[model samples]
Target: MTDIRWTLKSKAETSHVNNLAWDLQVSDEIANLLCQRGIKTFDEARAFFRPNLKDLHNPFLMKDMDSAVARINKAISCGENILVFGDYDVDGTTAVALVSSYLMQFTSNVATYIPDRYVEGYGLSIQGIDFADDNNVSLIIALDCGIKSIEEVAYAARKGIDFIICDHHRPGEQLPEAIAVLDPKRQDCHYPYDELCGCGVGFKLIQALAHGRGQNIEDLLPFLDLVATAIAADIVPVTGENRVLAYFGLEVLNSKPRPGIYALMTFQKKREMTLGDVVFIIAPRINAAGRIRHGQHAVNLLTESDYKNATILAREIEDFNSDRRELDQLIKDEALTQILEKQEEKRFTTVVFNENWHKGVIGIVASRLIETYYRPTLVFTKSGDKLAASARSVKGFDVYNALEACAEYIEQFGGHKYAAGLTLTEAQYPMFKERFEEVVSKTIDPNLLIPEILIDDEIPLSSITPKFYRILKQIAPFGPGNLQPVFISRNVYEIGQAKCVGKDESHLRAVFQQDGSDRFVSIGFGLGKKLDLLANQKRVDIVYSIDENEWNGSVSLQLRIRDIRPSSMG
Candidate 1:
């Protein structure tokens, strides 16, 4: 299960050419990728490469938006108490920060509440509502969650409190009875884009606020840094309007980062930041708050009014993230053992459980199992009388829908297409597991069980140039659907080979020559095991991403090697 082989499939160039000819000003390979991604016209290509805030659809276009905005405006005007309730993940924390900070400008009555990860679980809870009521809060804004909380929203509504739901998760057949349920996934929603993260949706709310106040939208552009971080961290597709948000968000992240980000950058030694930097360095720190403790730590860090406090909180979060990494690795190792022991079944799904596994890290563990096994995975741990589990799906399988099939056993569940969370009674775990496996075995194509590494395009090593790399960089803030361009070169000769080292000789550095004309340096992290295969072969094919690497204060263009194999002898 750990050594799943990835196969490369190359589509004919004609189809790619036909797809890109109308829009891209590039060679056939780049155009093919653009076309394959449905960028068919010049305008579409332009917008895809350069996302702007101006391109974000009017927020008022969402169903119930008018009511949501009016209620918020009334609260601001009347000086009524308002509470912002959010989940405990990065997306939830950023959404809470976006809405609460925006509202603080008009009224001090606004305060934020983040559910304790260990104590309260996710979304709007009756306890949260009662707390808001006790504080005399008349308005509640639920961010990043609450799409499926029909009961909780109804309870809050009955208490003479109004609710506004700004969420991105898929809603159930019956929508919540909140005053305004603003979700793009709503069947009636006509918003042009449907792939926003929770924080991205929150950004739209702020955008609407700016428009209502007749304020310049540019004034809110700085906040894109946070939106971009959430979009990247939440694993949302960075295409369409999200691309624009993350594109501008990265610029703000690198140029004029707020205190929280600045402190994180300094701590991580990330002098120059990119979307990848945010994904790898900054995001884990932000997420560590919810994983190891309460997400309020993250919210406080994001909205820190004092510079000194922000620095202290950033360092504290970094330590927490480090601890989380250790815990995640430990749990992942243990879960892998449990999975391997049951590999004889050859099943299409993996469901592993343990009594004492940390509830906070089950999601992370499930994600790791998915990467290794390339199957729909669920990691469950005992929680009270029920078993709480986190589920992750492969490319074609929808874990949320799969969970719905077993809803008879599930006490509660919510998440996106790829990731979800659920709770079920301990007595029903075995039956639900068998039913889930049966459902997946019947529905999933057997071939998709193997992980596939999709190469964006095939290219000649000679085709790579500074100009081409520059064009590629313009498609910044790559994530999920909009990925950093990957290129495959065939029949490449190994000019030189050595295990250039980092973090315990874990990386391999080498030089490659194609057609005996062009030589390129390539570095493969954790590919030292392939050193012998690379050295013995005279030539090989490589999958790589073009990058500029800075080493010891020197910069040079190089290939970040992804995978390689012997050249086809045929």
Candidate 2:
């Protein structure tokens, strides 16, 4: 529906692709896509296609793992009350659910804590420490957050409570003085795989404990469903160990999901769950508890053992999700209107603020703005005395670094290259906005402003055989590092009458053939306005990902169209 550049991915080694294709007995297209992902040899391809649990790196390899495990073991032996604390978002709540449940297996003294998004803000909050201290908890296991909570960690220490942190966010220059700080991203850490999400990190800790207890890895299979959801929700790279976790996690998710997950899945049709389904369908509902209510509700539901109770909680969370959706859409429209009213559409970055905006959906609103404005975006709302903002960046640009350049205006901020959050006084908002725009304008690569799609390969309709699709489908659990392949097909002709569908008539449905050799059904969501490309029997080019479409209880291969335009060569 919008202009986009289609670029072929960087070519892989030619000899390697041909040799691998011969060995694998598949098309060169599949081999090339694999090679581009750094899969060269047969062994590498084998491991990639079939991830083994034994392939997972030793849990003890992560820095401070022994210390963290030792402390947790000591607490369980001493019958100490342990507090599990995490952020309010999906990664955090999932981590809390995982670690708290795992610890509960050894002792019943474990308590899970999720900070109030509105009241306590983010990370290791002082109020959470106070709660831990009041409850006679002697140890606190912080998950997903606490990497940058130096003061709060010290605060917990002063209260005679030891801290063990399991986090995946990038560490600050100074590490917290906790009893154990388990973060793969730390500079001194020697963990082989650093891309684990918060829940993945939590998974490693429990894996270490189970090893100490002489528990077989099979005992941990039930927990994979939670790890997979966190990995999907956190948007971590789906390569290396992460893929293995996601693979097995999805297996558990489909086979024997927890009561909480099973309850949530009642809304989805009975089918295998993918990373996309977790991201769009499940994560938001989990996040909605924290956004619209208290994050503790999410932790409650995730750890609920009874299916009927979980269903009751799931029904409540669904209402929260519905409220979240309305808030997101309404805030997005308001933010867009603010941008246009301010005459700032031509700016290098989007900075919009509304004191009346709901703090929960500002991040979603910031993301929606980028789709319309196609630039770095920040959405701000009033948070008590100061103004809190959620920041999102365009592809290939580091919004975190841009915020760093304007650090003088920010009270505190943390996040990755693409997403971040910050707070500042209302008085400094204008300067921060101006300085952020200037920083991004000077530093961002000019080409990153335009959206682009990386095409894996160009192929004719005949290349898509049933066997080919069957093998291609093995590349499951796709995310950032490893993504579902998109292909470009040129000189394709429409074979049937095209029609606009959907409630808004914004969807395109048609059948196309190449050289009259094959006619495959295709559906392009949000491409109805471009139906002119098929008029007068004009040949057109298309960018699409292959998918299975189910209609009338029958399933067939279909091209999920990404974009379509008149053939450039013809």
Candidate 3:
């Protein structure tokens, strides 16, 4: 049988459940979860439950927002050619789509330029700048990148071209000489919500443009569907204003998705969709463009106005996504094999470099390694003369700062606390890798290296009712920061179990008997391995979320199992 561990909420946090219950008008069970998440005030509770777009922070509050908006408005007025330069990832491509579509209403001079993931790597490039200069593009809007393009921005400025940066990545000690820098993380900024993704920041810029042009904010809500997709795809925190954006965005996704999104959903045979649909069905297709081909295809798909062409493009992207999954799995397997052969000692950190690994999929490989090894991971692949690496870290570890410690060896780097990217000369990879391990070994606490599942709250099987499940559904469209509640049910008896329930062993269907009176059905996706363990156990504890399962013309409340472990059979 597999080992099982139970984690209880701290006593001090649990004690505040009553206060949370009174403040939030929720049951003590939900209050326990809120208290565990450190939500103490009523305002925090309201913000968590009911996020309103009206409460979004002012766009001008971001650093350099005023200058950035002014430059763009001036460009529109003069009808000068402007280029929206974006990264190749989903966040960057969606940022480009949002800003370019909004700007297109004012001038046809605006166009989008997505860097080639295989050829151009990431961020602002001199070749791109020179091309824009050659085309006489006077204004450049850098999205999802350019925070650390001090030299590139300076070079563009020297060519009489102005830049307005709308990046959300971590910044360096010095800022670039851009017309306006609009990152919430800037020290000088006073924006209330700081966890915006690149597309979220782009939406704020559009908000500023609408205000500047005397346009109503309602006109922009439709585009929030794209913003929400970026926020979810980029894995940004969904608290505060992000929650509102994603909430309403999901509505638009289900009701009036753009032609391209509609085509994608049709191709996937998803007639109805929720936020989960965007995460699983839509985001991956958009991401595949950047992973396997030029991200311009994604921008085109997003901007496509014809339904027939959108369908074709959608199918094309679907094929790309299929190919991307295969490539990712192959690379992940190879990388895992290399890690096992080289680092079998299980070092505190994993640093793997393969000359043949696909650079586009390294970040994903790094993330998978971090999930499996429960340690800080850096995956590197050969990129021209330099080695490009993606770094992912556990909570409480600042990966950007960790990269900064080895700045001398890194040619360039940027990102947030948990994820970052860098490039260094091929010759310097060994030294950088060694120094990275040394820094992490010395700086990171040993206890933080192990992975621990954070349980939200415990609920007895008898306490689960249809009304409670409805209340839980209202708080959905969940993501980082705002997460789906994970309820732990202790000492549940296994009444029945079904093997290979879904296609390709996609899921396990089972029934549980609680107190020999209440019966509930559950489905566990990717949890098929736990079926054997459950079959051997007389009683078990399960962690799950309540879901509404729809069958042939019928709907019923069901448990979506997360984890299952044996319980004492007293």
Candidate 4:
């Protein structure tokens, strides 16, 4: 039932494993994973282990930082009404919260604006501009968006408003004529790291402004919690500057979280938090505000100073998250049924549509669809006169480029390679769907269609110990690029209690062992149906990541099983 291929690193790369192991005094298995992650040298290993705030890149190194800082300072001095505009998603709302909160420290003339998803759609809307105009706002700092809003920026420009854009999205052929466009992705930009999320970009702007004011950049460390959450939720690579930010951000979260974050965690009992915790716990509650109600609720929660007010807002957002879960599951079930009824499972791509589907949860539904029919997928729903859709691609495929190929049928599309959003007239949906399938089937690498589990190393269960796990725990806040290490144990046998557990008996729990090795408990979430694979204590190969499980006031190392099969099948 498992077809995951186990990929090992090149022998040349593996050769450094021993040297790193000797240098760091860690096991060869851990060293192999470190070397594979490009941490071969002692200095690299040190930097990886110690993510210092001093290691962050200079904010002014980004192109246009001087101009952005100068213009913002002028607006603050003159007391010009300044507006912060951003998207409605986690990245956008967090960016708004970050920049607006930072600016309010210097001047009280700042205001934040998040466009309504259903009403104004995405990016620089004319309605947002009109609101700024009515409020006598002379300057707008656009975050997360406005990279491709050439016309919208010009619209604000003609209305006697200047714009400073802090964005990370790819620029269009014709760049917007804003006062300062601060995206590192611009062709002329020489910013070393181009992968900063929207909030990260906003943080850079804050850094530049602080430097301009002769203030210590360390004062801004408190805001890294938001930047870290955005980095995780936005799914940016956890490397270089991003890693540094997240490292300190986790410290901030665990030590002295903002009142808003404190309120969000009021119900959570866990004292220490990781990047994974931010993604699953904090991101969802913040995102729910935008999905079920309005994004401003999230910004309010982030910016609220009073703990009591933030607690009330957090509870409100929690209700929205609960509603989102119900709608998300219902729509996913309906989309699955639609695919089966249409008999389109054999197609190279999944393109499902229903006019009545909730537009708010379509992106989540698109991701869920891939589990049942693994391929590039798009979930479409009627958004007013246009049929808006969310696109999600499997690993190693570029959904953004696929959308570009079908641009003739699309009204607008924008996002990264793995995820994107677009809209088209209802009449063009069928053609767009056909064209997308054709483009993907022709262009996508055949091997990418199958999901893969890239094993970091092969080790005996005996190699795992308390000290090994203690060192592994140092690699906190894991995400893309620097994933948690996964190891394969070959010829392991089920020693005792291999049975289904959890609700609906959907998980497998067992104790596993190999020749002359101590038994290790394991849990295989969603692998209950594969219990037969352990029949009669057959020799098995398991791919798993080590985890600490606490039970009955005791702690022990356990394998969080990724995949398992009989040794013959593996």
Query: Best candidate, lDDT-wise?
Result: 2
TM-score of 2: 0.98
* Candidate 3 colliding pairs: none
Per-residue CA lDDT of model 2 for 1-570, tens digit only, reads 167878888778899999999989888989999999899989999999999999888999999999999999999999999999999999999989999998888899999899988888988999999999999999999999999999998998899999999999889899999999999999999999999999999999999999999997789999999999999988889999999999999999999999998899986555678899999888999999999999999999999999999999999999999999999999998888888899998899999999999998888888888889889999999999999999999888989889989999999999888899999999999999999989988988877888888899898888887887998889887899999999988999887678899999999999988984578899999889878768854789999999898889998999989888788778
Q: What is candidate 4's local distance difference test score?
A: 0.90
Query: How would you encode candidate 3's per-residue C-alpha lDDT over 1-570 as one tens digit per residue?
Result: 123334555533655778878876778776766666667778777776676777877788777788888888899999999999999888998899999999999999987899888778899989889989999999999999998899999999999999999988877789999888898988888888888999999999999989888877688887987888898888888777888888888878888888998999888788877767787888888988988888999999998889999999998999899988888889888878887788543677888888888887888888888767877889999888888999999877888888889898899888878888888998898898889888888999876776545567777888788777776776777787867877778888877665647667867788876784468888888788878878788889888888888889888888888878888544
What overall lDDT goes with each candidate model?
0.84, 0.91, 0.84, 0.90
Model 3 residue runs over 4 Å out of place are 1-6, 11-26, 34-48, 343-345, 498-507
Q: Measured by TM-score, how close is model 1 to the native structure?
A: 0.95
**Model 4 Cα lDDT, one tens digit per residue, 274-341:** 89989888998898988889899999999998998988988899899999999999999999899889
RMSD of each: 2.2, 1.1, 2.5, 1.4
The segments of candidate 4 whose C-alpha lies over 4 angstroms from its true place after superposition are 11-15
TM-scores of all predicted structures: 0.95, 0.98, 0.94, 0.98
lDDT of 1 by residue, 205-283 (tens): 8888888898877899778888989988888888778888888888888898888888999888887788788888988
Clashes in predicted model 3 = 0
Greater-TM-score candidate between 1 and 3: 1
lDDT of 3: 0.84
